[model samples]
Target: MIQVRGIHKSFGEQHVLRGIDVDFHEGQCNLIIGLSGSGKTVLLKSVLGLHSVDQGTISFDGRVLGDMGKKEVKVLRQEMGMVFQGSALFNSLTIAENVRLPLDFFGDMTEAEKDERVRFCLERVRIDPESFSKTPAELSGGMQKRVAIARAIVLNPKYLFCDEPNSGLDPETAIVIDQLIHEITHEFGMTTVINTHDMNSVLEIGDHVILMEKGVKAWEGTMEEVMDSDDSAVVEYVFRSNLFKKLRAALKKA
Candidate 1:
């Protein structure tokens, strides 16, 4: 599990996250959702350690991240994996090579061991084995996302982080991607954190949901609770549309 307590972050004169507290459980897809400037992205970065927090603490299991020494921080980073909004694959490298990059840089595995690991990860994400040698440019957007996920898990990380995992895919493809990530989180029992504005993803895979507004945590709960919530920020941001209202009604009827 990952725990955040009294998190406060600032950028020069602006305070972006204020007294945010939440817990992300393992074997679950935890979602951070909010409007564009609601501090969701900044909160995700703070949890990822890409941006340092100005106050409070973040802990993975029982280890406090803020107190980690240089060597300890490096070790903690090895246990974490990230999938970016853009898929961040190397255009020059083959798909297999891209997945193997982490192992090449961080693993003690021999060549054969790395090859086997890469192959397993790719297959796990449903990428065709025949496409191993293809560059990122050759595949569709969804396929690139699958490759990114394969690479993120190649190192067998204990925690996985995804930012806008369904950014540019068609709705059908986006659902596939969301399900893939959810399955991996449960199958590997990894603590997964996802930052997204995709409401479909929220309803489909949000095991734990945190709603943010204006640098504060406005609400936190499971999807079922989210639907029943009366919080203004959550209602306005997540269910303001008639389409979403109809979807909610459909879900409730089911």
Candidate 2:
């Protein structure tokens, strides 16, 4: 589990995250959802150690991240994996090489061992070995995202972070990616944190949901609780879509 307490962040004169407290559990997809400038990104960055927090503590299981020494921090980072919004694959590198990059940089494994690990990770993401030599440009966006996932888990990380995992894909493809990530989280028992505003994803895979507004945590709960919630701001934020509005109307009439 990942525990965050009293997280505060500031950029120049703007206070982005204010006393945010939340817990992200293993074997579950913990979602951070909000509009632009809601501090969701800042909160995610803080948890990932990409941004220095002004206050509060973040812990992985029982270990406090703020107190870790340089070597310990490096070890902790090695245990964490990230899937960026853009998929972040090198256009020049082969799919296999991209997946093997982390192992190349971090693993002490021999060449044969690295090859085996890379193949296993790619297969786990459903990317065929036949496509191993292909470049990212040759694959569709969904395929690229799969490659990114393969790379992220190549090291068998204990925690996974995904920023806007469904950014540009069609709805069906997005859900496929969502389910893929959800399955992997439970299958690996990894603590997964996804920063997104996709309402469909929130309803589909949000095991734990945190709603942010103006730099504070406006609400936190499970997917069911979020849909059932009557918090005005939350209701407005969530039911903004026509689909949800229709669902709400039907629920009321029922």
Candidate 3:
């Protein structure tokens, strides 16, 4: 589990995060949702130790991030996996090579061991062996995203971070990716934190949801609680979707 307590961050005159406190549980998809410039991204980065918080504590399990030394921080980072919004794969590298990159950088494994691990990760993401040699440009957006996921998990990380993992994909494909992330989180018992504005993903796999607004945590709850929430920020954000609005109305009638 990851815990944040009274975390505050500012960029010169622009304050991005204000006294944010939340817990991302292990073996669950903990989602951060907010509008543009709402501090969700900053909060995610802060948790990942990419940005320093001026006043607060972030703890992974029982270890506080601020108290860790350089070597300790490096070890902590090695245990994390990140999937970017754009499925940031190197176009010049083949799928297998991309998945093997992390292993090359961090693993002490022999060549054969690395090859076996790469193959296992790609297969886990449902990528065929025949396509392993293809570059990112040769695959569709969905396939590229799968390759990114395969790379993220190549090290068998303890924490998985995804920034809009479903971005740019069609709704069906997005749902598939969402389910895939959800399954992997539970399957590996990893602490998964996702920064996304996709409402469908919120309703589908938000085991724990934190709603941010104007640099503060406005609300937090589970998926079912979100459906029933009357908090102004939660209601406003969720009902913005016609589908959710209609679903809420149907539930009211039922």
Clashes of 1: 0
Clash pairs, model 2 backbone: none
Q: lDDT (0-100) at residue 49 of candidate 3?
A: 93
Count of backbone collisions within predicted model 3: 0
Candidate 3's TM-score reads 0.97
Clash-forming residue pairs, model 3: none
CA lDDT of 147 in candidate 2?
Answer: 93
For candidate 2, the lDDT comes to 0.92
In model 3, the runs with Cα more than 4 Å from the true position are none
Colliding pairs, model 1: none
User: Which scores higher on lDDT, 1 or 3?
Assistant: 3
Prediction RMSDs, each to the true structure = 1.3, 1.2, 1.0
- Residue by residue across 24-135, what tens digits does model 1's lDDT show? 9999999999999999989999999999999999999989999999998898888898999999999999999999999999989999999999999999999989999999
lDDT for each residue of candidate 3 in 88-130, tens digit (9 for 90 to 100):
9998899999999999999989999999999998998899999
Give per-residue CA lDDT, model 2, range 193-214, as digits (tens). Answer: 9999899999899999989999
RMSD of 1: 1.3
